[model samples]
Target: MSLSAPVLAFEENSGLDTAESAASCALKLVRHDALSKADLSAIEQLAHQPAARHSGNVFFAPRAVAASASLSRGSIDWLLWFQDGRLCLAAPVVISRIASFSLVRIWTHTYAPLGTPLADKRLRPDLLFEELADRGFSALACPLLETGSTLATAVALPGGRQDGRAGFWSGIAERAVLTSDWTEAAALSAQRKKKLRKMQRTLPLVHRVLRGDAARDEGFRQFCELEAMGWKGAAGSALKQSDTALAYASELVASHGAQDTLAIDSLEDPQRQGNQSVAMVISFEIAGRGVVWKIGHNTDYDAVSPGYQVILAASRRFAAENTPIWIDSLAGPEHPLVGWLWPQRLTVGTLVVPLKGSHAPARTLSGFYQAEARLRQVARALRQRLRR
Candidate 1:
């Protein structure tokens, strides 16, 4: 924490619609290394707050962000929103230079499914964009924002039709989500469920939701090792393929688990001598929201659908625990298994919002962004098809 860093002050009213004096509040750009303990606490509180619009997530939580920072390719910076001289919203972003343009985007790992700004209930997204623009930024690049979120809806809509929305926006996409209800747990066809049940009876499967350090460590290790031995290994994209990626993931799990917010759900064959795990799922729950982060299964158990069984185990746990919000699938939108099994779905996408404007600049910037976004989507589709 840098006590000597100059405080960057703004003359405008706090972007937060808090009851406090709409008096002047400051916006400070504090580098990760300079974040104070107080700032980190504020972020955690906002993320844990049920009333916060798009801020309720574990990805941007202090320890998670810090762990991600260690493995990130860009420098981490925090943008704080203050109201009545108190921190109201925060966005941790990675600032970089792209083709003579300064790109400020949400600080999220490739696997992070949400880019929600850590914000107060009434915090406005445009306020942050305007602040960035005043600091010479052209726009804010936010990726993986939820489709139905107020801010995301405005960004995805043509022409920023909503009042006080982003000046311009682009790139809308959809992701899968499963409602945390027992009703949603059996969305698969009756025949498929019957097959899974029969496989379970034959395998004598033991479902475990590991939360303790020792147990979770072992289970997560099993998961990473399993993933590495499968297709991800062939693709050279498994966590164990990169020392740093694996270490960072371990740290992230440990950090979140310390708060009782992480779990490793697994299915093991109790009939086997060593009780070997056949499948595993890494999940994080903060307050009411749950995220199904990763899944891995032993190919040897494909006939039993170990992967699906473990997923079902996780879903049942979430429902029994009464998880308030839906669980993000984190799997691709086109993912066959989870997408077919989980009836509910949500959209998420990468988008850039032109800073503080309504007319010519917004139109030109948004049009260019939409065109680029289409190209990127086409490239991604081609890659997927090629891989298939």
Candidate 2:
């Protein structure tokens, strides 16, 4: 499918009013084989709203969809629901052939994150599943639902017909949430604090949040390069190494930057005037919350623990913000780096709904898949035990 041009315009508005409008307005669903210009614009607008969650403007953006779809052998469907001329729910569905049946996912493999159809808490999500299946989707999978997300309830069918199953696939969608009283020093031990203090005194490092276009662009590019410098680069998974990734990152900065959603925090080394950045973090503000999406640092500065320093500075900055928002370390539960610092683990799960309804065959297939997944998990645990 041919993708339309990228649209990055989004304006913040009152959530209550939007929800009310969505509840009362007439709903209509429009499906396109390829992403249409109007749908792209509407999707971005929905993504920027307070109702959206995790990787809101980044993964569901037009550029992201195009990139992910380009690399996958699947069909793309840009589905949008218009309520009284306003875009209410935008669901980008990817359909891939799996054996004799087709598998449906809210997202393609191009993007790491996925999003469900945007809807108010009052809406019944079963309607969503029925509509998609009526339109030819074999099954609908929501792979990125937060533990307490409204989608979990919104998509539920009446009469206990919500036959979908949700499971916590560790390392799938984890986050670190910090309270108002969170402190950088609290995350580090006394010995580590002393060492960090010494590093800070030696170089007199400065942490700044870059806001200007040139500065933000440079910071983002530097972050990509820094990520490419380490294991990600060696493993050929770095964003800087892929043209599609470069474009997606560029669009994220442009779109979110315009709305003041994108934030680039950098730890600078004055001694290295030519290369001031020792560590950097790329984060975005959503619904008054901060989501730290990426972090990178120069390995050469490991002696000073520049990576930890940068994270500390960013966390402190979030704490000091007048808005009183919590910072979410998007790193998963098993992340060795951020796990030690942020003790809290956000619960996330995936909801799978069979479009064909809960038939005997569908039930059997679901049971088989669940058994297979459990076997894999058990085998993985046994391997870890053996290693120990």
Candidate 3:
């Protein structure tokens, strides 16, 4: 069947107003390809709201949403809850199912991390979740949800939970962020600072802060090349390894650059042939906060610790221009360099909310899946331990 333009549909008792009126409000499900001009405008407006200020900008805009869907080879459906003609809650989901159990998952990717749903202050998440339960979704998988987030207070799956149940297969989204203090030389240990200084003096290192669409695009292309020359290339996981992934990178950078939120910083070795870049870090500024989204480094410069030098310099520069908001690294928890650099932790895990009046079979299926997730976690833990 051909996809139609974005259509707004009403559902009973879905409003965020009084309990009665809220139930009668409409919940709009707009497919990514079907978003209309009006829908985009509302989403943009909703993105700028104070409540959404902390949610990363990538998942809020039309271009970012479309790019993620295309790059990840997944379809996105935005579940919208509106009150008084204004958007109260906006959740972008990629639907999946297990036999009878349908799930609405917050779209995520290895390259791009997504935050929680964008919901205004007036909207109650628990009530909205219940409403979704009525819509035939057996469960909700909110990955990349920060720990202690009140927005997604529902029960969690087999991954990390507040109750201290640690699953072996749990993945943590520990966004590496730098505080304003990191920009200061005093923030570094005496040995680290001295090493950085020595590297700067001995190496013909050139740092360039690339801005605007053209420069950002150029940097992205260079980044792909740089990453492909490293371990990721051999591992077949670099952006250039897949056309779709590359397109997604291009789209995301272009979108963020157009909004003036994209920042690409590169550390080049001027003395080297081709003026090769030693390290490059891509970051996005959202609501005065910086998120260090991606980093690529030339393994040839591993001896010089090019990634660390570049990231430190970039952090200092970013801190100077903007009030240093916490810059989330979006790196894995056990990242060697990033973990050492940023001592603070932001926990990320999956949340599973069983739909209202969920049947026993569906709940049973969820339990089975959770068990499998736990086993995977255990295997992962064993691998890490053995590697050590």
Clashes of each: 0, 3, 16
Give the poorly placed runs of model 3, Cα more than 4 Å off: 1-18, 70-74, 148-150, 153-175, 180-183, 273-275, 359-388
Which sequence of candidate numbers ranks them by TM-score, best first?
A: 1, 3, 2
In model 3, what is the error at residue 32, expressed in angstroms?
Answer: 0.4
| Cα-based TM-score, every candidate | 0.83, 0.75, 0.81
Tell me, by TM-score, which candidate is best.
1
Rate residue 232 of model 1 by lDDT: 76
| Residue clash pairs of candidate 2 | 68-110, 125-154, 125-155
Residue-level lDDT of model 3, residues 1-388, one tens digit each, is 1111111111222343556655555678889889888887777776665555455345456676787786544578887887656777776778877776777877766666655666666655545655676788776666667653435432233242232211111234455666656645545889988887887777758889887775566888888788888777876878898988777777778877887878888999877887378798888776665578778899888878888888777877877886636577776556666777776676665555556453343335435545654685687588567545
Checking candidate 1 for backbone clashes, the offending pairs are: none
Residues 1-388 of candidate 2 have per-residue lDDT tens digits of 0012111111223354655654544434333436667667777667666665432424455554554555555656665655556665666666676555556666634334435455443443444445556666565555555545565554433443423331212223456666565667688899878887798777777888986585457878788878887656776868888887777667666656776777788988877867588788887775555567778888788788878888878777777773556456655555556777777666544455556543333334445544654575577577556544
Q: For candidate 1, write residues 1-388 as lDDT tens digits.
A: 1112211111233344533333355688888778888887777777677754344556776655666776678888888888655666677888876454566777777666578776665554445456677787655766666656545542333542344433334556666676655464367678887787799777778887788685457777788887886667877989998876776687778877777888888888866655388888898877767688888888888888888788878877887785566677876567766777776777665555555443344344445656665896787688678667
Span of 10 residues, lowest total lDDT, candidate 1: 1-10
